[model samples]
Target: MENANDGKYVHINGNDIYYESYLHQQSAKETIILMHGFLSSSFSFRRLIPFLQKEYNVISIDLPPFGKSGKSRRYRYSFENLANTVIQLVESLHLTKITLLGHSMGGQIALNTANIRPDLVQGVILLCSSGYMKKSKPLLILASCLPQFHRFVKRRLERSGLENNLRFVVYNQSIIDKEMEEGYLAPFLKDDIFFALTKLIRDREGDLSKDILNELRVPCLLIWGEQDQVVPLEIGKQLHKDLKKSKLIVLKETGHLIPEERPEEVFHYIKEFITDKG
Candidate 1:
């Protein structure tokens, strides 16, 4: 689960996008673009990638304004922009017909990417995906406009403590080790993350509507943690029903961090999915 390999960054939409590539021995078979959740980075896929990279070319990204990626005030943090950025990053690498595998907020971005450019994306895998959430309310949007808003966000994060956030995401606390906490906390050590997060507050759009999801032509594989508190399993059920071509799998006793909690099972399912779909 450690970042054993040093990742590189690519300039996209006037911002530097950070990504790590794990190539299989013979990568002509399949390719996967892995995206992490809100407040997460490519590190989230550390365990999952080891198994995936054994068979598929895996690329994990740190969505802008998080991790090592550039935190520019001018960079729009909207989901649409982020999706486009992902597509541009893939095209920049000259990779096409790849699958988009995402968790939580990244799941929304993956869906948006497929919806935007299905020619580049052949499949989508969503784990504990975010769905049906509305845009930021007027009050929160107004609050983000304030000069001291970034400070407020910084203080709130400090007050909550990273341990609490980690506990909230996982049903089992045994996995909350020193390395895991440090991996997640590393990106926020700099003060600039606060302002970028504040901008994200006003920049991010709502999750896709059911109508839009229903029209997606790409085949989808949705995995949900039964005990997830962040995004309930019911959302996954609804997502399964919404997408015309999708299969949902529920992992009991698991929580929001599906990759962290069930890498083996996830990898197994992914293997079966690609083989069956192919």
Candidate 2:
């Protein structure tokens, strides 16, 4: 029953984006839009979505080039454009005032979406966001500029390498089971994946600066794994300090893959966040 969720597709920007929706009997006054991180898909939330759908409607998206979603060589992969596509998806599906839940790179896209369309987002939840990663740019730019270097990087994403990379994201290594490995690696095996990724990295620009963070008038929640190796705990601490009306919760013994590593804890925090009347 783990992979029972059947996903549907929406056409946008000449791409067929994939998403899974969990509907509740209650009216859809509020909903949660889940966005996965870099090199990840909505399958990351498979264990967590059931808990969320119990009380409110929940939808998880597979950002193009990263899930069952279709990819195009011509589609721009910048965060802004991706965020706009999410907005279009929301509008097309008639969702209103959603709480944008984004993990890592998806968090950055959520922040960008909230900034661009504050009217559509009721709140924002960040799971070890990447906007504060200042050291990543130079390395990304270097790799993007060097074709050979990029190829070398791509080589590391082969089957075994992909499994290793998946294990690297979580503090608990036991969760790197066959299902998890396959779920994360399947997207990369597609023919156009590398090209789409190249475009994504080459087009990377801007960050959720203090000005944009300050301008975010909606409620924001910051969740971090105490031992997150990828984005680090310091970034989360700094992000919490910068946001005026945000609550910060750091989970002990957790890693960047909080949803997979500790879904119960994640669900608890998110449920409280959405229900809070303050």
Maximum-lDDT candidate? 1
Among all windows of ten consecutive residues in candidate 1, which has the lowest summed lDDT? 1-10
- Encode model 2's per-residue lDDT on 1-278: one tens digit a residue: 12335679888977789999887766545689999998899988988887877767888999877888877867878888889999999999988889999999999999999989999988999999986544247777667666555465467566448767776789999878888877887787655777777767767677778877876788999999999989998988888877777899999999999989888889899989988933
RMSD of each: 1.9, 2.8
Model 1 TM: 0.97
CA shift at 226, candidate 2, in angstroms? 0.1
Residue 224 of model 1: what lDDT? 93
Q: Which parts of model 2 have CA positions greater than 4 angstroms off?
A: 1-6, 134-153
Regions more than 4 Å wrong, model 1: 1-6
lDDT, candidate 1, equals 0.92
Model 2: lDDT of residue 119:
92
Model 2 residue 199 CA deviation in Å: 0.7
Itemize residue pairs with steric clashes in candidate 2.
none
Write one digit per residue (lDDT tens) for candidate 1, span 132-227. 999999899999999999999999999999999999999888999999999999999998999999999999899999999999989999999999
